[model samples]
Target chain A: MILKSKVAGKLLRIMLISSIIFAVISLVTTFLFVYNEQLYLKIYKFDQFISVFYMILYYLLIIVYLVWLYKAHKDLVELNTMYPITPKGALARVMIPIYSLWGMWNVYSTMYDHFRPIKSTEKLGSQLKVFIPFYYFLFLITNGLNRVLLKSNTGLYEVSDILYLVSYSLDLILLFVFLKMVNIVMKALDLLMVVKQDIIDDTQDVSGQPKVSS
Target chain B: MNLITKIKEKKEYSLAIILLIIPLIAAVVMMYPKHEEFVATGDITSVEELGVEGSVYFTYVHEGIIENLYEKFSVSLTSRNEIEFSSLDQHQYENYTAYYETSDKYKHNTIVNAVQNAEVKTDSQTIKISEKSQKIMEKSSDYIGDSFGLMIAIGLIEEWNDEDFSQNNQYIISGTGTIEYDGTVGSVGAIRHKLLSAEMNDVDIFFVPKDREYYADKNFSNQVEAKKVVKEEQLTVKVIPVANLDEALEYLRKLP
Candidate 1:
């Protein structure tokens, strides 16, 4: 029972964190609406409100999750006291909220950027499956460079820095799209191999099982 | 158990793999630099070393103010910010008179000496002057107008119009070097020295006179001595009926 409860708590935390990440990204993008003015002055005004509402809803959900997290911890502590579960396991369950929040915050901005209107919405939606990890790697590289440059007295030429940042971002986006394509092909191959194996195994399995010599 | 065979025997995903590779290849090729010459010339230091110089031209025109033949039209020249010239109108046959004085009892004849023995040609007198002269005229609208305070309208045209130039032919004007005067002629003299020191190239100006008899030997940019067909007194030194840029300049100089 203690183990089951701990797994359920982890799953809940992951779900809440994912939702928060989505909400935070939507909010950040909404605020950067000024950047979109150049593409078309007439943006759908409701986009901003929708993002705001989503953020609020996510925050509320997070609060509810925190309450549930507290209850789950309490229940785990009781379970640990009654059963053979260790104190470490109970503490770990209690700390899942913080880990989840941290994970959500780290990736929220990038995930939100995938939805920007510059690209075709449908294409971006499909591409983002690959885009996320690709962009994470790109961000790590660029952010490291940014920090190194910050230490030097000779700051980067503003235009060059901006251009580099944009280029890196674009490269990541392209890589993400490529990875997504690869992922789809791999999945299709896996499915086909499974089906072929299943057909072969269907005939072979009955004999191999030493059929219940009933 | 036979992973290698399974991978090889699986229907080749050739279409999907090729589709993926094409875009990747295209992107890589497109990202390479395009224009080699422009990239080579992108250095700005050399371009800055080559000096740039320009001239300002001013063409003065007036109308609806010619009461008597001698009563010349008063013209005021100004810049975007301040007025530069305010002179009394005068008419002339051979040479007009310009009365200028520096002081209260001051007496001065600001003369625009004519190019002696030089024949003039050109329709608009202003066009025959230096390149600087043309530049000043082109920017005249910026210098003129009530925006700069003094609204000195000489004719119905609020501003100098190229269309009116051929009609009256009585356009009073003058030309001077754009020198920073430190309140003295000595400073003006210094300007000439500086210009010469820099080895500034002159923008050649020519005038094809209506009466070609004003010159015996005719060549562009060549100075010549010639006699005037009309007497000095009979010749109207007014800027009106100015043949070309050279004639206009000569007429301006002849004005007292």
Candidate 2:
């Protein structure tokens, strides 16, 4: 059993909160521009600055996530991973361009398969496996729909605009889903570490004095 | 016990280190945020060797220092992190919804007329905007305004005529004004930042709406304010005031 670091849990929380904040910022910015175009331009002229802030936050989140992912993969390798992948090998698949889109999907599937047999992580592994593909399709559809709607020049504030609202709403939902998945995994990891520590403490208490010969 | 020294001996210091370091990093990152993240910069298109230029625009986003401070305390107090829109203070959103609705409704007219005044005959007089142009038409960017009309009209005229109006083709030029149906130029708000952008990008000449009509606050007009900023800041970019499309064309024709 792994003894989790306090830093990892705190970072995970930060990562989750930052993603939500970033999304809310995006929503507010978009809402202001549509609801009050003139004032948005005149007053809140910090649009580009905000985007740079978003970029920095986004990159920071990615770094922390990859580090934890690498550690998890390392745990599998220590026990002879079924897929014959190293922690570095998994990272390479994710970071390499053109190959990454497919590579990241594969990495998720491999993790799911490895973890599916473990009693503690079985439910999470199964849930992730189901959700991963659904999330992928949702991502593709939302992007495609937006491109189509934008190019059509059908104008805004019409029947089709509802689709725009839907796409954004779905985006919000998926972001929550992604963060929730991370949260569940993190909590499970924490629980496993705590349980292991407790069992060790109990054993030490039982063996406090040597047993007398029977 | 040796992997992380302090953390290996005591796991809780890991949280302490992270809590202290994150806000410091965020503060540093905020110090150097940029004003422009460009889709295109200082690029002129050549249609049969005539230069046609357009003003660049970027999509928008929001951020505030208050949110960062709020987040620092949020994680410590609660497990459920609720998304809050009220965190952003009250804005022009409450009073200007009707204005936004009307402008957004008639937005296409501004774009179409700009193309038409350039006298570029389209397929049955219906303006088929470029894919990029279409995206900017919706309330998607700050560029969705009449101020961009003058440069776009000029650019279209050059493209349709297949020759630069000025014929010098030496200096990069750009500007802003509303294009009326009869080819007249009208005033638009917020010229100071646009002028600053032009200077920073080294645009040689910029056309602004001439403040011909007298008002109690005529100095607040696009042309007058642009000139004032140029004078005060000693901006290298020249600001030229024009009454209409013909006036701008006349000045450009006379440019040696």
Candidate 3:
């Protein structure tokens, strides 16, 4: 019992550590995405090449981190004898990278290829419509980890800043929500393992068979 | 373990589904473009002008008989022809001068003859034996409205089409106008006073085409002198001159 508890605790720790690392990486990348593009445009005036390169590198790091996380998750699940790998974990593992990359590709296309300074109020509204959704997802994931990365300003002169702040804050909130969902997933996995262990113990007398050690 | 079971059983897949849909919606919106439309209204006119300020010197010899004296009389005529003309009035004289100096040389040399021959001056004004044209009004581009509100008050001018021409609206109205003085001080006095009242009454539009032409044409020194009359339509509803229909339409669209 002690050994099993220790092993499960170790797995839980691994999951927590990996999730934290993943959240941190995603948060930093998003911050870099916003700050480097927006602030650098005003202050540093970096060219398009540098801006695009920064984005690519930022996303690449996120991809590598996610891959490392998934491998850790797979390894941890392989060690568990109490339950089979949940289909939800499999689905999450498949979706996280694919959808993430899809989202990143969308950002790349919009920023590098389609980006233009808005010329009119009507155009600005249309552009915001296209942009708000993808950012909303990023928001959910980021805010879940208790990180607040957006600021606000007032008046016409700071209108752009206010919009930026609001959009990023909303994105962070969405990201946080997603992270909570991930936590729910992790907790459910823990409960499933506990239930499976309970079932195996209860069935030992009926089959008159030696219980498999968890 | 049941936590994972719950995650497996009731996980929301809609977020990913929403992600897929947004881009498609964006793509549809981006691909379809809307055409912009502009509305315009007003009087339209164009103006051309010509001015000549020079002295004419001519000498002629004539045989004259007075009662008992038959004598040779030599007359020298020297005068200043300081004329300011609108291009419309000068159009007839320009062709006359061109033909007289080149083809005709001398035979049919009167200004009347020349006017009779021109393609544009098909209708000639006959001098009435009992009375002459009291005043001739000529309209020109320079014939601007005396008061800004006159154009708005008159039904003739509107910036944009309104369902009702009410007492209040902010839109521009433009037109050229002229009033003639019939050589008599009395008539001039009456017309001037009438003009003032007409402006106040929003009846200023009636003075433009006919009244102005009668006055200005009579004021001109001679038929040879240039006279300008701004066309009625040219006064407000501005239209661009283009060589072709397509170009004209394009130009019209570009107007404010």
Candidate 4:
């Protein structure tokens, strides 16, 4: 269970890093186009291949992350009775197009709330809370604007270009937020496991006997 | 959260905000239009100003020195008022035409100076040239600059100067160069392509700009490149390098 959680944590970090790189390249391409149309067109032709390669890598990473999340959530179900959303529901919400945005918000919020200590002394939960709404808001705005831009016949290229750039920039911010939140959650999980082990060791010392499971 | 704690919590957000701001600044900077400067500038008259329209024809008589043969090629120049240099193969045509138009104006002025210098008495003060071709006509819409085409224009003008059609039909002459106000021929590009074209037509005498040792590069310079292509192709045509219009005319006069 611990190994599965670690793998999930690692995949999330990888996705965040890749997202940052993709965003940077996208911005650079946009800047080149704006600065010199001719030069940008030439470079863009070559960069299309690179963009496709990155997209393939991104999708593969996402799939691996989802598998890890499913396994970790399954393990959590065995240890705890309370789950705001089922493991399958969490995965489905993020995978479905229209529902993915809300699903993402639900998954992150549930994870944050579930992982909070029962005593209410844990500082990790609050750190994770601050950026969740902000990330969700940015994601919704960026995606919603993108859909509108696609359908609208607005010939305002420069304005649309700026809006698209803002969307990518917001995405980069969200990715960073996600990376931080994952790291905090992972650290908290590790601390909780260490505390559980300590309690078990203390009980064994007092009884002068080792606890065993059938 | 306390003020200090709130500020600390917002620190990560600030870093991300800074990252986003850089590209925003760049987008704003690129929104302004960039001014592009022309590479080469020359003076040439547009065909519109000269009142020449549609396709015009020019005849060149080729005299074979070895075989004692004469062949006349009827060359046609197509002109359109549509101003677009659409050939992707020769991207330099646009810039070349810009320079060619400027050079042509100077050529016109030179002809006027020559006519005035000769003390010729004529009722018409305006020195008009029907030497305009389709290329120049298209310059009305799309500018095309080529030094070789400019040379051809000057050659047609020189042919017109004699007025005796028999004298103009005596020899077939083909050359490529940018003409200056003083009639000094400047070097042109694509010397190999021009040579191949000349050879394909079995030209009697091919004229190129005289090589300047200082300006000569391994890839460029007329004489050496021309010699290499002629020898490789085993062409019987003669390659003569001329520095100016005087030298070119002198060569033609010497031609039997």
Candidate 5:
């Protein structure tokens, strides 16, 4: 299940861009609902339609992202046999509910470490160590607040509304951070591929054979 | 490196710089206050229909620091059958009043005098408060601070003038401030939250104490803070600073 770095990078870029778009739309819709309740209610059907459409698209995108992540993890596992988690374990960690929060950190950390050895020039691994944990914190808090909001019937709707809005804004910020992280990972993978090809070329040269062209 | 590789590296560097700058730009945009236009005119008819047509609706200044910029609430007069004095959520009125009664009797006397004045000024025979109103006051005790007594007094006055409150005014009026025995409007905290609440309720005019415009060591005045919040939230509610209850009433009376 070795995924090509190029394909994986492209997938990550797509995910990043799409996530940004989705976040922007979510923020705009939230603001619309907050600022103009009457107008938003009048177009409630259309708003619901858009929300459902985005939910479906988001789930589909997450599936694709998870698949790409699994493959990337597999590649890293093969490259680093002494990796802490096996490819199967990494995938399971990410898929399982509640565990996924910690699992995501594990997966990203593993990916970061695997890429670190191949490309020492980019300190992306250290950056991910910070960004990934911070992202997870924001993610957990947002989801936790959302659950609280759903269950509570206390007449403090305004307080809950403020909390929800703050959570959502934090989520938007996490998206930006996530995109930067993906970019760093993609760059590392690109460098790793280049480094691996150079090694192969050097070996061919030493074996008295002509350099293999790409 | 080959020429193609060099060109690619340059492109990537440029892209990275742009990516790094995006979040910084977003932070600046969010923090920098934008100017907003506020319409002073409100639909008085709509407010009247809410059964508080002539009632002097008091808005609470939600000054507690909040992360959400778009939180919404409204000003409304809850009809009550009886008036019950109660403590605020976080701070007990007795602690402050009792302490002031002995240690700082001047401040305590001022508060007591204000409450008494508000009561005496109101036609209490016709005005009454309900349990729901008491609950709302209790819930908002933290934001309303020690102004609960003054608010009750104003509520009674509004209830008394319920018939003539909206007769001359065409715009809905909402306000946050303490009413004194001398008809002076004292400054309150959380003007930003109160302004947003008024806007959420579609209030036309929000009255604040003119003296609240500035305080020691504060960068922005109450009016400026209200404007900034209004702009940030993209609300269309107007904020008017008043020196006293008479000024607020005069402004409301002048409304077409």
Candidate 6:
């Protein structure tokens, strides 16, 4: 939440766009190196240049994603008025090995539960039902398989290529899903503001003492 | 708005903008058309390098820049290290790369042929080292360097003569030189660095090409350069200068 929602959204978009362009160029350079060795040598300097740019963009991407993750959790807590998980706890849980997916589920499902009853966010809440678990499990299986294949020296080495392809393909899918989730969280923040107001109103019992807000 | 206006406005926008712009500027500077050359350790004894017939090819990373980010940040460290830095610009990079490509395509075949046809006199009689059908050179890298030509020829000759040219037949043997079509040993660049690598690999006998006027700069051939480094550095490896394959074969045959 150190970055406000609007500011975080804009930064993430800029970083994501740069990352995609650099990644594409890196892939293209790889193909050129593989298919045309002569041309690759001729432009090898450019390939080196692009790979460095891509790596920097990759690190920037990770930082922006973490920022967004923290901001979204903060938004979820502010809406639900329930600290199922604190913002920092949710942010830290994202990197914890075994409990990572479990933590993500707690945060997203809590947000989904809060969003489901609200009239404006019911549709976005439904998307989370599928998105939350699938995102974690898909990456968990692919990344776990990658580590498994790494320890194996013989037969699995060949299969590692296919595994990498599948993992990267899933990464591309997550990219689009990531942008949608960020947009949805912002939308949820706006819609849930009205819901929080209603809860404050309902708690007053036709008296002013229980209600306290602008 | 002018800086005076912002100065009076009491904002940290200038510092904020500087923080944002600096890394972007550094990124652009990293791509600023550099042509720095780097030297890395190359293996000559491991794998199939000195076997009956094996070649360790050289890699030409002649790009004007570097591979990783930390390496990019170490421009000063790299510049100060003579072995790690070279004056090989983009043109030289392409030329060196082409040399490797051409060496792999042409020289490897020529060395193979020269070795099969070459005859060395043993204690009893003169004979061809390897039969044409039996001697197949195993190439270890994508780009074969010409320097390994002499070694490829020597490897087969060693097996043929039942010889181990290592010091007192106890230490290891490694060297760098190209083999011409006529079996003449050709000079290679960066012999000093190559000798240092061979020293690190603990080679006992290093065969460098003898002085040739064509490749010699101010009469400093690879042999001169190699021996100078060896004597000056007080290296233990014996430097043997071979003018041709026959000289290398005779040296190995006569080694007691």
Chain B TM-score, candidates in order: 0.17, 0.58, 0.15, 0.46, 0.46, 0.68
Error (Å) of candidate 2 at residue A168 is 5.9
- Scored by lDDT, model 1 comes in at 0.29
Please give the fraction of native interface contacts (Cα pairs under 8 Å between A and B) kept by each candidate: 0.00, 0.05, 0.00, 0.00, 0.00, 0.07
**Best candidate, DockQ-wise?**
6
lDDT of 1 by residue, A1-214 (tens): 2232333343334434444444444434433443454432244333333333443444444444444334443443342334222334433433466653344223323223423332323344345544555545554555565455344312123233344335334433433443343343233223334544455566565666522333
Question: Chain A vs. true chain A, TM-score per candidate?
Answer: 0.30, 0.67, 0.35, 0.77, 0.78, 0.72
lDDT of each: 0.29, 0.58, 0.30, 0.53, 0.54, 0.61
CAPRI accuracy category, model 4: incorrect
Model 1 lDDT at residue B162:
22
Between prediction 2 and prediction 6, the one with superior lDDT is 6
Which is the better candidate, 5 or 6, if ranked by lDDT?
A: 6
TM-score-better candidate, 3 vs 5:
5
TM-scores of the candidates in the order shown: 0.19, 0.44, 0.22, 0.42, 0.42, 0.68
The digit string of per-residue lDDT tens for model 1 on B24-106 reads 44434433322110000010011001110111112221211122211121111111111122223333311212211121111
When sorted by lDDT, best at the front, the candidate numbers are: 6, 2, 5, 4, 3, 1
Candidate 4, residues A1-214, lDDT tens digits: the string is 2534665565556556766787688767766766667878788534453444444555555665687568566655543547657779879978899898679887777767866763331677777778789878877887787666554422223255566566667766766776787787677666655655566687675576976655
Q: Lowest-scoring 10 consecutive residues by lDDT in candidate 6 chain A?
A: A151-160
The reply for model 3, stretches above 4 Å from the true place, is A1-44, A47-50, A83-161, A169-214, B1-256
lDDT of 5 by residue, A18-49 (tens): 55776677666677677878877787544444
Across B25-103, the per-residue lDDT of candidate 3 in tens digits comes to 4434433322211111122221111010111100111111111000000011111111111221345445544543453
Scored against the true structure, residue B127 in model 3 reaches a CA lDDT of 32
On lDDT, the candidate that comes out on top is 6
Say which prediction, candidate 1 or candidate 4, comes out ahead on DockQ.
Answer: 4
| DockQ: the better of candidates 1 and 5 | 5
Candidate 2 per-residue lDDT over residues B1-256, each given as its tens digit = 4768857565445653564356446645554422221111122222212223422221111211222332323222222212223232234433234444565544555556666677643233444555424543642343333556666677666655554754554776777777787888888655665666576666788788887574568787777798788999899987889988888877876878
Candidate 5 lDDT, B73-144, residue by residue in tens: 101111111112222332443444454345333334334543455445556553333432344344432331
How high is each candidate's interface RMSD, in Å? 23.7, 13.0, 28.6, 17.1, 13.0, 9.1
**Once superposed on the true structure, which residue ranges of model 6 sit more than 4 Å away at CA?**
A1-3, A17-50, A95-126, A137-168, A201-214, B1-27, B45-83, B89-113, B116-141, B158-171, B212-220, B228-237, B254-256
Looking at candidate 4, what is the lDDT of residue A93? 79
DockQ of 6: 0.08
